[model samples]
Target: MRIDARRRAGLRAGGVAAAAVLALTLAAPATAGDATDHGRGGQDRTYSFTVMGTSDLHGNALNWDYFKDAEYDDSAHNDVGLAKISTLVDQVRADRGARNTLLVDAGDTIQGTSLAYYYAKVAPITEGGEHPMAAAMNAIGYDAAALGNHEFNYGIPLLRTFEKQLDFPLLGANATSVRTGRPAFAPYVIETLHPRGGKPVRVGILGLTNPGVAIWDKANVEGQMQFGGLVETAKRYVPEMRRKGADVVIVSAHSGADTSSSYGDTLPFPENAATLVAEQVPGIDAILVGHAHQEIAERVVTNTATGRPVVLSEPLRWGMRLSVFDVDLSFHRGRWSVEGVDAQVLNANTVPEDPQIVELLADEQATVVDYVNSVIGTSTEAMSAATARYEDTAALDFINHVQAQAVQAELTGADAALPVLSIAAPFNREAAIPAGEVSVRDVAGLYIYDNTLLGIKLTGAQVKAYLEKSAEYFKPVTAAGTYPASALTNAPTATAPNGTPDYNYDVMRGLDAPLTYDVDLGQPVGSRITGLAYDGVPVGDAQEFVIAINNYRQSGGGNFPGVTTAPVLVNRQVEIRQLLIDWVTAQQVIDPATFTATNPDWRLTWMGEPLTVTP
Candidate 1:
C-alpha cells in the first residue's frame, strides 16, 4: 500500500492547484425550482419524463439463487435477480415510451455471488469473453451507472474489462487517478430527453461512490486510485453539469444517504455521504442511493443552498426493487423547467423473469452452478446459520475455526504465540450445511459476502473496544422488566441504528473464551461490553493478540474504531472461501463436537441500572 515516495511527493506538489481548481469550480448556482416564476396566464408547455435507477445488483442476473443451487421461483418466495428486473424495466419503458425513459444503475454489479466470482476469478474475462453482467445490463439498455466500492474488489484490471464491456459509461467522479488528479472514469453523463411539442430536456447524471473503497480495496487502489469525498466531488461537478445546459441533474450515488462520517470526521473522505451531497449541492433534482442495502420508496430532502426539493430513492438489493422517478417538466421560454417530481418503487417479483435475459446468460449461470456445487467435505449433522445472531452456533464457529486455523498456519513461531482470535458475522440466516457431503455451494452459503481475510495485531483494549461497538447491535434491558424477555427484544438480527446493516455485528473465536457482555439501558453505548475475558482471564490492555478479520472491517467498513489504522500482522492474499475449501478437504469430516469443545465464545445479554448479569 506504500506508494512510491517520489509519486507521493509529486501528488503533494500539485495538491494546492487541485484544491484551487476545486474551489474555483464550485461557485453556487441559482435555485433549480425557481427557473419559472409567477403568472398562470403566461404558463408554457409541460411534458412528462421517467427516470429508472437500480443499485447493488451484485451480479444477480438470473432468476436463480446460487445458495439453493436451483432456479429461483415464486414457490420459494425469494426476490431473485436481474432477469426479473428486466420484466419491470419493460413495463416502465412501455408506459413511458422508450424515448422518455432513462435507466441507470448505482454500481455494485460484479462481486456478490458465485456468478460474479466465476467470471472474475474462475473463467475470467479473456480478450473475446463476454461477462454475463455486462451482457445483461447492455440487453436491458442502461444509459449510465455509478461505480460501487466492490467494483475494485477484483482489482483495476478486471474492473477495466467489465467497464469496457459495458455499452454505458461507468461514472465515478470521486474515483480519481492519483497520478493525474483527474477522474478515473467519466464524471457525469448528459442524456437529452425528447418530449413532444417542447424543447429537448437535458438530463444530467453524476455518479458518486463510497469513499470507503480507499480502505476496502486498499490492496488494489492504494497507490493507483485516490477517492475524494462525495460532497466535495458533487460540489465540483454539479455546477459543471448545470453550466452544460442540464435541465435536470440526478446523482447516482453508490454511497448511503447517512451523512455522518463512519470512520470519524478526521479524514477528508466520508464513507457514506449521499445525504451530505444532496443537502449541500444546490442543483440536484433527484438522487439514487446504494451501497447500503436498505430500501426506501422515496424521500425528498430540501437542498441547504437553494431550498429546492431533491427526491431520493433506494431499491432493495439483488434487483428486487427498481427506484422509479417520474418527473414533470414545464417547457417555457425555449427551456425545460422543473415543475413536479415524484419517486416510487416497482417490485421485480410482480412479473416473470425476462426469457431473453435468461437465455443470454444461461451458460454462465450453469457454469457457476457446477463450480459452486462441487463437493468439498462432509458434515456429521445439519448446520444452520439462522440462529448465529442469538447463540454462538457452530455455523458461525465453523467459519471462525477455518479462518483461525488458516491464520495460525500462515504465522510463524513467535507470531503464533500471541493468543489469536478470528472475528466473523453470520451474514446469511437461511444458509445451511446439510448433513453428509458438503459442496462449495454449502460453504458459500455459510459465508455469503465476498470478503477476504486479514490477520491483524491488536491489544486487548482494542479488542474490547471492537466488541463493545459490535454490542450496539442489542437493545438495552431495564431491570424492572421481565429479564430475558426484555433482553432479547432488539436481539432479533438487523436492529442496528442509523440504518446500519446487522451483518456487521461481529463475534470472535479463539482462546476458548465466551464473549460475555451486559448492556445497561441507562449507560452509554461504548460501555456496553463487560465481563470480557480470553480463556477465563480478563483481556486487559497489556495483552497482545493476533486477530483475523474480513478485509471489510479492517478497511473501517463498519466504522469500527481503531481498525482502519491497525497494524497488519499478515495478509493471506487468499479468499476465505478457498481457504475454507482447503481446510474442509484436509479435515474430510466437519464434526460439531470439534468446534463446540469450548463454551460459547460470545454473548449479548441485557441489564438495567448498575448493569449486572442475572444469575
Candidate 2:
C-alpha cells in the first residue's frame, strides 16, 4: 500500500527515500530463522520490529513548568512538552532503524496544555484550519494512533479538522457517528514492510476508544456521535481486518489497566476502560493501551475466545517515558503471526534530546509558553495545591470558601441568609505554594480537572453519609482511635490480620454532629455508618438539605459512590478554575491568613490519641 503523502512528510523532510541504497551492513546479525517462509515450507525466519507507543500526551508539547513560570507564582503545575516528546521519538527511531520499528500513540494526544487551550480558544482548527498538535504529530511520523476521549473535547467539527490534518489514519472501531452508523474514522490501517528477498508483510492495526466518552465529554460529543461497547466493536472489526489480508493484528486501545487492585488497600482505584477492553476483545495479537496515564509493561489477556495475548504498554504521561515493544513477526500459510514480543520503558531523563525534533517544536513551544505566562490574575499569599494529608489546608479551604460563596450567592441570592457548605477533593497537591506571590497559574494548582461547581440538596443523613464517605479516606488507628494514615502503608501483614488498614477512609470538612460507632475496619459500608446523627438529632433517611460540590463528583467523574445518582440543584456553567480566578481578581489581594479550615471541630484521633492535623 502506498503511504499517504502527509504521513510520509517526516521521512521526506529528512531527504530519505525508501529505495535509497545504503552500505550493506547489519547492526546485528539475523537469527537462524533468517529465511522467509513465503507461503512455502521453509526454514522459519524471525523479523525483529520495535513498536514505540505513547498515551495521554495531554498537550504536553513542552517541558512542564510545575510552577507555571516565576511571574505566575500560582502553585500551578505545567508539564514536559511535545517538543520534548519529539526529541524522545527521534532517539528511539535512531536506536532502531526503519526495518525494525513502528511509532504509535495510544490516545489523548489533542487536549490538555496551553497549546490545547490556545487551539480551543484562540485559533480553533475548525474555522478553515489545522491544529498545532496535528502538525506536530505529522512532523514526528506517527504510524498509527487511536482515539482518546479528549480528542472530542472540542467536538466533532474540530475533531474532523484535526483528523484531516493527520497524515496517518485515526483509527477507532468503537466510536461511530450517530448519523452514519459506521465507524467515525477508519476502523484500522495496514502497513507493509519489505525485507531482503522476502515479500511485504502486512501488519493490521485497529483502535478502540473508551466507551465512557459518552459521559466524560458528553457536552462536546453527545449530539454528534455514540460510542459502542469496546468488546462488541473489536469483535466486528478484528475479523474484518483479518479478512482484508492482514497478517499480524495489533490493537491501539485508548484505555488503561487496573493497578489499584494489584496495589491493595488503595481507595478510588480509577476504573480504566482499557482493562475491560483487553479482557473482552477477541483480538489477534498485541495491544497498545493508554488514557489512564498508567505506567505498565506486561502481557494481559484480551479475550478467552481467541486466547490472544494482549500487550498493554504505557509510558508515564506528559512525555515522561516512551514505551517500546519489540515484536517478532513470522509468516505461515500466507498469514502473519506474532512470534515473540518484549517491551521496555524508555525514560526521557536517560536519553539526549533530538535536535531536529526540538527545532520543529520550538515555535509551538514558545507560543504556548507566552500564552500561559500572560498574567490573568494574582494572589498576595502563596496559594497551595497540597492535599497530601487531609488536615484543613489553606489552599483547599480557600477553594471551598470561594465555591461556597459562589453557590450561596446563586442559590440564596445576594440578600438571602444561609450558611453554604461546599465540598472539594484534595487531589491537586502536586505543587506546594511557598509563601510568595500567587498568579492565575497558582489557582490552577488549587484544582486540576476543569470541573464546575454543582449544587444539590441532601438530608442530614446524606450529609453524614457524604462526610463518612470522605472520612473513608482515613481509618481509625485502633478500635477506639481516629488517627488516620496512608492506608496502604498501615495495612496489616498476614500475621496481623485484624490490623487491616482502611484505604477509603477520608475526613470531610464541615458538619458538626454527634456520632457513635464501634471501630470495624472490615465492616460493610452501610453498616459502618451506624448510629449516625446530625445536629444532635438522628439523621432522618428522607430529610433533605442543600449541598454543594463540583460537577465532576456530581456526574460520577471520580467514580464516587452515590455521587453519580445525586440530585442536581443547579449546574453552574462557570468552571471552578474560572471562579477561583474571578474570586482572586475581585479580592485584588489573597491573604493566606484569611484561609482556615472553618470546620476544625471535625477531628480525628487514633485509639483516643490525637494525630497531628496537617492540611
Candidate 3:
C-alpha cells in the first residue's frame, strides 16, 4: 500500500515529455466561445458537442430516507434519485439534440444504500435475472461508463453478467484479463457524432478505475486481473484512439483529484494521476473524474511542457449534479483540434422527475422502504451516538468496552485483570437510537464497515505512535499542539465558522493511559511520535500488552504503525456489528446519560488552553 514517491516523480517527468510532443502535433491558434456561442470561429462551419457525466450514484434509485419512512419524498432537500437524472438528461438532450450530446457515468453505480443491498442479495443479476441499473441506464441512454472499484464487490463472474445487461459499453483501459493478456473489458469507445449540416466528429472515451482497487477488494479482483496505473493506461490508449479516427479524446476516470499531503498506506492522492494524464495522454481534451465524491467543475490543468489547458470536471455524487462540458472541435490540416471548452454544473433539483423512470423503480422502492423501516429492538431512553469534542460517545465507548472485555476474556481465561483497551473509530456516529423501537438499520449507524474484531499485543511506545498517527488527521493549533481545530475548537474563529468540529478528525480510541508530549503537525513520517509513556510510567519499548481493535486496523486499514507486525491474540469470528448487537441485547435498556468519554489519556488544546467539550 506504500506509494513510491520516486515512481510518482518519474511519471510527472514523463508527462512533461509527452506534453511537449502533443504541443508540436496540435499547434494551432483558435478562437474561444462562451455559454452562448455554439462554435469556435466564424459562420456555421464549426462542430459543437457536449459531454455529460455522472458519478458515485451508490444505488440511490429513490430519494434518501432520512426518517426511515416507508414512502419516499421527492420534495425533500437534496433528494437525488436516478429518475431525476433521467428527466434532466432528457431535457438537456431536447435542448441540444442527440447528435451533439454524449452521456457518460464515472462508476460506483452498484453499491451503498439499501436498494443496492437488496438488489444484490434478493435478485442478483445472474444468467436469467434482471438488473434494474442496466434497465435504467438503457432507458436513459448512456454512451459509455468507467468501472468503479466497488463493481468488483460481487466478483468478476457476476460483474460480467451485469455488464452483459447494459446496452452501452463499459470502458476500463487498465483492467485486463489474466489469461488472455488483452483487456478483460472494453478499453475505450469511439463515437461518431454529426452536428446539423456539419462533418462528423469522432470522440474517444477511455475509462480507468482507481489504482488502489487491488488493495480495496483484493479477494475479488487480484486473482483474475491486474489494474494498471491510470496515467500509464491513458497514455497507451489515447494515441490508439486517435489512430482509429477519433478527433477528440476524453478520459472517464473513476479516480478523483486530491490536493492534500496526508498520504499514507490507505489514503492516496489522485492529483498525480490527474496531472500526468492531462499532460501525457496525447489528444485528450478533457477528463471527467469520480470516486472522491467531490464537486469539481472546469479546473484548468496546464500541461507542464505545452502550457495548453486540459479541462477537468466532477459533479458530486448520488445523481445530485450533472457535469456538462462543451467543446468545439474543428477539422483543419486534415486533423481535429480543440477550439474552445467550457463546463458547468446542472442542478438536479431544478428539473422535474420523469414518470417512466419512477415507475421502473417502484417495486425496488417498496423493498428498501420496508427494509429500513422494519423494527428490531426498542430503547427506553434516547441513546445518543454522537462523538463529543475531545471526548468519546457512550454508544461507541460501551461497544468498545464490550469488545475489550471480550478480548481480555479470550486471552486470559476470563480471570486476568490486565488493563485491556479496545479501539473504535468515531466516524460511525451518524445514527441515533431514538427513545423508541430500534431496528437493525439503527445498529448500522454504530458499526458500518462490518469490520471484524482483532486483538494484538503492542507496547506503550507503539500505542503512543498509533495515537500520534491518528492525530495527524487534524491541523495543529501551534507548532507543537496535539489537537486539531476540528476536534477542540469551541466557537467561530477567523478560520472555521460553524464551531462544530469534523467528527473524522478526533482522538484515537483506546490508549486511556495518560502521557504528555509535543506534537508536530508537519513532522516527517516515523518521527511525529515522541515522548511516549503509559500510566505515568515510561513504558519499556519491549513491553507488550494486548490491544483490541477491528480487523480493518489489524490489516492496516487506517495506516496505524506497528499494527501489521503485532502478534495476534484472538481473531473473533463475529463482526463489529454483531458485537454491537449482542452488547445491546445484553444491556436491553439504553440510556444516553451513562455515555461518557472512557479514554482520559487523549486531550486537545488551542494556544496552551484546554478546549471545552460539549455534548
Candidate 4:
C-alpha cells in the first residue's frame, strides 16, 4: 500500500504526455446500432471489435449442481457453469468475427462450488493435476484476467498453480509485495488489432483488484501481498499504459461499480470502487466490473479529469450471464481513435452447454460428484436454514455447535477454562439436510464460504456489542405486529445502504449453555440488543469468554467491534465447512437434540413485546 515517491513524479510527468495523446485520439459520434463505419470515403479506417467478459466463475465448470446431484436450474430457469458461458462466447465470436473479439475474466475463479472444494482440498491441482478452471478457460482462449479476493482462499501456492496453468496472464495492478512494494502480477496487457486497410489498434487492458483482499484474505496475504486503492493505483498505471502506445484503455476491475464498502471503514479504500476509478482516472474508455454479482448492461460515467464518458458493465455470478462490450474505433492520420462504446449482458440459459468444455471437464466433474454424493452420516430430523435469518433455526445452530466443539477441544491453559461460544450466519437459505441421510454436499451447503476457524477472546460487554452490531440487519419497528421475513430482514444502513447480506448477520451461541438475547427491532441499531445472558445468568461486563469465529470476521471482515484486536485463543487454520463435514463423518449421525437449546435461543421483539414473523 506504500506509494513510491519516484513513481508519483514519473506518473505526473506522464500525465502531461497522456493529455496530448488523448487530444489526438478524438471521440467520433456513433450509435450503438452501428457495428462499424467505413471511412468518410472508401477507406476502411473505422474498426468495430467486441470484448466478452465473465466474472466470479468460482470453479463451476459445467451446468451441474453437485449439491442436488443434478443439472443446475432455478425457478428463473437460469443455467450456471462455464459450459453454458462457452456457448454464448462462441455465438458472440461468430457474429463479431473471432479475430475482432477478445475474451477475459474478472476473477473469483478458484473457489465457490463443491467442484472447487474438491480440487482445493480433495484432489489438489498443485500435485501435477490440471485445474478444471484453467483447462476450461485455456480452451476458451482468454486474453487476460484480474485477480479476485477469493483467489487467496486456499493460499498463494495454489493460486500460483492455477495461474501457471492458464494460457494468458493473471493481472493485478495494485497487488504488491509487502517486502518489496512491487506488483506481484502483470498490471496490464496490450493486444494489437489489425484492420483490413488501417494501422493496427493497440488496446490496453488494465486489471485492478479489490482492496478488501487485505482484510478478507489476511490469513493468506498478510505480510506477503498488500492491495492498494483502485483510484490511486489506476492513476499511476493508466498513463504508463498510454505511454506504451495503447490507443484504447479497457479496465478489467474485480471490484463492484458502486462506491460502497461492506467492511465499514476497515481499510482506507472502499471495497466497491469501480465507479470511482472511471470517474477520477483519465484515458479509460470502458470497464468490466465484478464482485457485486449483479447484471449491469451499461453505465456511463463522465471522467472528472477529461469530461469523457467511461462505460462499465457487470455480468451475473457463477456463469449465469456474459457481459459483451462493443467498442468502435476510427483511424485518422495513422492514429486509432475511440468512436463509441456500448455494453450488454447475455443470458447463459439461452444457449446450450458447450460440448468441448463439458467433455474436457468430464473426469474432474465426475470425481467431485461422487465425492459429494457419498453419504457421510444420517440426520435424525430434517433441518433447514430457510428461516435462520429472521428466526432461530436448528440448521444454523448445527454450524455453531460444530464450530464451538472444535475450538473447545483445542483450547489450552487459561483458554480451556473460559466458557466457549460460537458465531454463525445463514449463508444460504436453501441449504437443507434431509432426514435419514446426509452427504458432504449437505453439510457444505450450510457453510457456503471458504472461511477458516479461529478462537478469539472477548468480554461479556464486547459480546453484547457484537450482538448489537448484528442487530442492524433488522429494520426498526414502531410497534409490535406480524411482519413478513423479507420486510424485516436486511435493513439498510450507511455502510450497507443496499441492505446487509445474510452472511454478515451473525448469530452467536454458547457451547455449554444458550447465549440468549433479544433483537428489539423497535429500537435503533446500536441499542437493539437486550436481555443478554449466558448459562442462564445475566452476562457481566467483566466476564470473559472464548468465542469460535471465522477468520473473515476475526480478520476485520463485516467491521465487527473488538474482534480485530481480541486476543487469539486458538488458530487451527482449518476450514469451517470441512470441520462440519468431518464432524458428520465421525459422528455418523446428526441429532438436533445434542446442539439445539431447550429454550428459544433468541427472539425478535418490539418494545419489550415478542413480535410475530411470517415467511
Candidate 5:
C-alpha cells in the first residue's frame, strides 16, 4: 500500500508502510471478534471500505463544558467532543475493519473554548510539549486532515508548530503561498486501503477551505498565505489526481456545501462552494463538508460532466456529529470500480465517552479549569449580553467601552483629537459578568474571537455607507405587519450564509445622534441607519474621523464596505480579549453604573413610525 503525501508527491510506500498497515489489521481499534466480516462470493468478489470524518471540532476535546466546568450534557441528552466520538469511531472502525477504514477531520480543530484558548494563548507549546488537542487526535490516529480558517487564528508560527506535531498531513488545496503561488500545505493526501486479501487501493482525498479566510484572518494570512475559490482550485487539482491513478476520490472541504455567494456577485470568487466543487469538479466520489456548522446527513449532486452522483456529508460543529461514507468496489475489467456509495451522519450523543481519551487529557483539562477559575477582577453589577441581540445590554457595552477606551489610551497629541469611534458586536448572547469576582473565563466569553483592534479612518458618508451595508442584515419588512425585533436581526438563508452573525454586525459608539435603527425596512436596504450626528451636532458626508475595529471587520469579513474604501490608521497586533483582561485587572471593578452611563447610540425603529422596546 502506498501513502502519497506532501511535496514528496509520490507514494513509493514509505519505510514504515508495511508495519503501519499491520496496526490496522482487520480489527485493532476495536475488538477483532466483533467486526462485521463482509463479502460473500469469489473471483468477481466485492470489497468495501468506510470513510469516517469529523469537522469544525472547535477544540471540544472532552465531553466537558468549560463554561459550566462540568461534564456536558444538553437537554437532548447529547454530549459533545472528540472524546465521546472516539468510542463511536472505535466501534465504526472495528465494525468495518481498520484496514478498510479511513479516519479524517474537516478542520477548525485548535481554537475554541477555554481549554483550547488556554493552550494556544496561556501555555505555549514548546519543542516537546504535549498539546492536548493534537494529543487527543494522535491517539485516535487520524488518516489525513484539512485546515480550517480558525487554524490561522493563532498566527502562522503556532499553526505551523501544531502542523509539525500532527501525525497526519494537514491538507489545504486552496491555501496558497502569496509569494510563490503554490500550495503552502499539502494540497491533498492519499490513504491506501488494503482490502481483506485483495490488492491495495488508493483513495485520493482533496482538501478545500473557504476563501473568506483571506478576510477573516487578514492579519495573519495577508502577505503570507492566500486562498483561492474552492471550485476553481478543485477543478485544477481533481483532474491532476485522476491522472496520477486514484481509484476513488474523496473531498474534505472545510467549506459548506451551500452554493451561496454572500458578496452578491460583487466579490467574484465564491467562499462557500463545496456544492460547486461537486457540481463542477469531475472524478470525485464523495465530499465531506463543514464551516457552516449545518448537519448535512446525505446529499447527492449529479456531476455536470460524468452524470454520476457525488455523495456529500457534513457533521455539525464542536464534535457533536460524525459523517460516515461507505464505498463498495468490485474488480471488473482488471480494475477496481466504485459500485455503490452511501453516506450518513452519527451523533456523538448516542455513545458513551471514551474513558481512554478522558484519561489522556485529564491533566491538561484540570489545568485549564484552574486557569479559568483564577479571578481577574470584580464587577459591581451583573452584566448580561443575552439581551444585547435585541436591546442595549451591558455585556456588549462592556466590550465597546473596552475598545473605545483602549484606543483612546494609545492615541496622543493632535492625531488623538480626531473624534474617536468604536465598532463592536455581541459575540455570545449568553455571556455575562457577575457582580462580584470576574475570572479569565468571563472575559474570554465576552470577546469570543482572537481579533485585534484596528483603527480605520473614514468620512461621515463612508461610515454611513458602512452602516447601511450592515443594515442589510435586516430582512426588508415590506408592508410591515408587526414584525418582531428578532426578525429585524440576522436570519441566515441559503443565499446569504455570511449574513450578520450576532458577532459580525457593527454597532458604532461615537456618532452623537444615537444612530437609531429607525429603519425604513419597507424601503430598500442602505436606507436604515438615520439620525446620525457627532457630539449632538448634525453630521454629513464631509465629516472625517477615526474609528476602532477588529482585524476581521477591518479586512471586510462581513463584506462590509469601509476597510477597502477607508484609510487604515494602525493595526496594533494585540488580542482584544487580552486587552479586556488587562483592563479589568487594572480597574479591579466592573461597575455597570460607571461603564453603562452612555445612552445607546443605536435603536431599531420603523421609518416614519415608532417601534417599541418590548422589554
Candidate 6:
C-alpha cells in the first residue's frame, strides 16, 4: 500500500500500523520514522519528525474578511485564513519530507467567520450540506484536532455533525458526559511511526478544552457535558498513555499558557493552565496552546515531577501563524525514547495562499460574500461606532434597544412587569453602517462576536455596582480637562493587569426609559459611578430590574459583578448578531433618530461636572 493509504489505515484502526505494511514503507531515511539503513532492528537508530499546528482558525478558509466585505488587511498588513497557513504547511512538508511531518490543530475551528455562520445557521450542514471548514481541513490532511469553547456556541448537535464530517479524530480528554462522568469525546489518539529498519514509535496526543465552557455555554452544556481542570486531566491521561506504550506525548490544549481565570474561582480550575499542565504533568513532551489569541514562538516549562523540559507554542489566532514542533527520538533497549523537542511559529503572511485551498472553497466563499452583501434593510442616516467606547453613540444604543426588546418580550410571570435594561460594549471601533442600503455585513460588523443574548435580574444597587466595576475601564483623572480617548480608556485593574479590553467595559441603557449614570473619572476605581438613576429619578437600592446581557458577560466572563449569580430570566439561545439581522429585516429601516437617546445616556464627569473626551 501507498504511504498515504498506510497513514489513513493507522488513523482508522486507531493503533500501530501492520508490521508487513511497515516493511513496505516508502524508501527514505530523511523523512520521519525512516531509518538510515533498511536493515532489521537490533542496533541503535535515530529519527526526526515535525508536527505542524494551528489554533483558532475560526471559520477562515480564505484571505477575505467577511466583516469588511473585502480582502483582509490591517495596518500591520498581516494575512489571515487557512489558505495562507496551508501554503506555509506545504513548504514545511516539502522541507521536512511529507511522511516525516504531521498536521494538527489546537481548537476553535468551527466558528468565527461568515462562512462558518452560513453553513451553521443559514444552510446548516446538518441538513445534508458539507461544511466548508471540514472540507478545507480534510483537504489539508489533518491528523488530529481539539475542541474549542466556541465549538459549543451553536449547541451540541451542530458540533457533533461537524465532528462526524472530519476525517481525523477530535480529541477532548477532559470533556466528559454529565450523566456517566465519562469522556464525551475521544480522550486521546495514538499515532505510530515506522522507521525504515527501527522499532515503530508511538506518539500519544491528548486534548484538553477550556473548563470555562461550562460557564460560557451553560445554556448549551449545563446538563450534558462538564469540563475538568487541565492539570488534573493531564495527570490522569498522561500516565495512561505511557501505559499504552506511547513513546512520546503531545498535548493540544485549548487553554492559554498563563495563570488566570476570567471566572475567578467559579470553578476550582484556572481558565488558562497550559503552563501548569506542563509543569505538573510529567509525561508531556510538547503542548500546542490556544484560546489566548497571542503569539508565542516557544515556551519551555520544567516539570516539577520529573524535572524535564516541555515545550509549548501558540500560533496567534485567525490563521495568522503556524506553529512547528520538531522532535528527535532514539531507539534503545527495544524501545524508542524522545531525545529532544523544540518549537517555533511561521508567519502566514510570508507566503501566498495555497491555490488548492482557494480552489476547493471557491464556491463557498462566493456564497458567503453574496449573503453578506445582500440587502437586508435601508438606513435613514449613517451611524458610526467610532467613539462608542468613551461616549454614548447611536450604534451601541441601537444594539441595546434591540436586545432590551428581545428580553422584554420573553419575560414571564412577575418579571414581566419589571422595567428592562440592556448592556452593550464597543466591540469594534471601526464598525459603521452607511446611509441607504444596509447589508448583513453592515450589521454583523457592528457586533463582531458570536455572543447570544440573555436576560438576568439585578437590583438597583447591583446595577450601580456593575457600572462602578465597568468604570474601572477609565483611568482616574485629577481634574476635568480634554484628554485623549486612549489615555482614559482600557484602564488596568487587578483582574486585567495588561489593561482592560474594550469588550469588558459595558454600557447599560433602558428599553422604554433611560438608565442614566455619570462615570466620574476623577473618583477612585470602585467609586466612579455617580448620578445613577432610572427615568430621571434616583434608583433605590432595593429596586429590581431585568437586564439583557450577553452569554459571555452573564457567565462570569470579564469577572463582572453580580451577574453570574443573578437570576436568569430569559435564555432563548439566540445569537445576538442573528437577532440584529432579523430585527433589521423586519424593520426594513435603521433610523438613528428613533433609537438614539434624546440626551446623552452617559457622560464623563469630574466632581459632578461634565468633561470633554477626545478620540
Best of the two (5, 6) by lDDT: 6
What is the C-alpha local distance difference test score of candidate 1? 0.75
Over the stretch 104-189, how does candidate 2's per-residue lDDT look in tens digits? 78888777666676676557767655677777777776777788877876777777767767766677777777887876676777
> Per-residue lDDT for 54-88 in model 3, tens only?
98887766555523453334444565767888888
lDDT per residue for candidate 5 within 1-615, as digits (tens), equals 112233221221232211111112222332221212234443454678889999988889998877567787676776789898798898887677666778889988887667777778778774357678888887887777888988887888888778776667778888888998878887777666666556567788888877867765677898999888888888888877777767889999988888764333434677578888889888999999988778999999999998999999999888898899999887654567888899999999889888988999989989989987799789988888776765666776678778877776666666577777777787877788888889977877788675777676788888788888766776665453465667677856454775556765667776222333344566577777777777667677988777888877875687777675566555544578777886887888888766563676566656655445332
Compute the lDDT for candidate 3. 0.64
Ranking by TM-score: 6, 4, 5, 1, 2, 3
Better of 1 and 6 by TM-score: 6
244, model 6: CA deviation in Å? 2.0
Per-candidate TM-scores read 0.73, 0.69, 0.68, 0.75, 0.73, 0.80
Q: Among these predicted structures, which one has the highest TM-score?
A: 6
lDDT winner, 2 or 5: 5
Full candidate order by lDDT, most accurate first: 6, 4, 1, 5, 3, 2
Kindly give the stretch of ten consecutive residues in candidate 4 with the minimal lDDT sum: 17-26
* Top lDDT model: 6
Tens digits of lDDT, candidate 6, 1-615: 113534554544552211101111233345444655423554677888888899989888899988778888877888999889889988887788776777789998887777988898789988887899888888887877889888988889999888877767788888999999888888887777666666776778888899988877777998999999999999999998888888889999999998776566668999899999999989999999998888999999999989999999999998999999999987776778788998999998899998988998989998989998899899999999999999999999999999999999888899999999999999999999999999998898889886878898999989999998888898888887889998899988888899999999999999988889999988887888898999999999999999999989987888889998888777664679878987998999999888787899999999988888888
Give the Å error, residue 615, model 5. 8.5
RMSD of 2: 8.9
Candidate 2 residues lying further than 4 Å off, grouped into runs, are: 1-44, 70-81, 127-130, 259-276, 378-398, 401-421, 425-438, 448-459, 465-541, 544-615
Error of 5 at 408 (Å): 11
Candidate 1 stretches with Cα past 4 Å from truth are 1-43, 71-78, 376-397, 404-419, 424-437, 448-507, 511-538, 541-615
Cα RMSD (angstroms) for every candidate in the order listed: 10.3, 8.9, 11.6, 9.2, 7.7, 5.6
Query: What lDDT tens digits, residue by residue, belong to model 1 across residues 1-615?
Result: 111233323433444212212111111121122223333654477777788999999888987767677766454365768888888988877676666777889989997777887788777895459889988887887777899988888889999878777666788888888898888887887776655434567888888888877765677898889898888999989899889888889999998877654345435777677788889988889999998776888988899889999998999888989999989887666677787789999888788999998898988877888878888789999999877765667988888888887777667768878787888886877889889999987877887665778788888899888887776665655443444423543344344445434576788777344444444444456797767777777778878888888877887777787787777666634567766765777888989888764555555444533322331
lDDT at position 120, candidate 2: 67
Candidate 5 Cα outliers beyond 4 Å, as residue runs: 1-43, 73-77, 261-268, 378-394, 403-436, 444-508, 511-532, 539-615
Model 5, residue 12: distance off in Å is 14
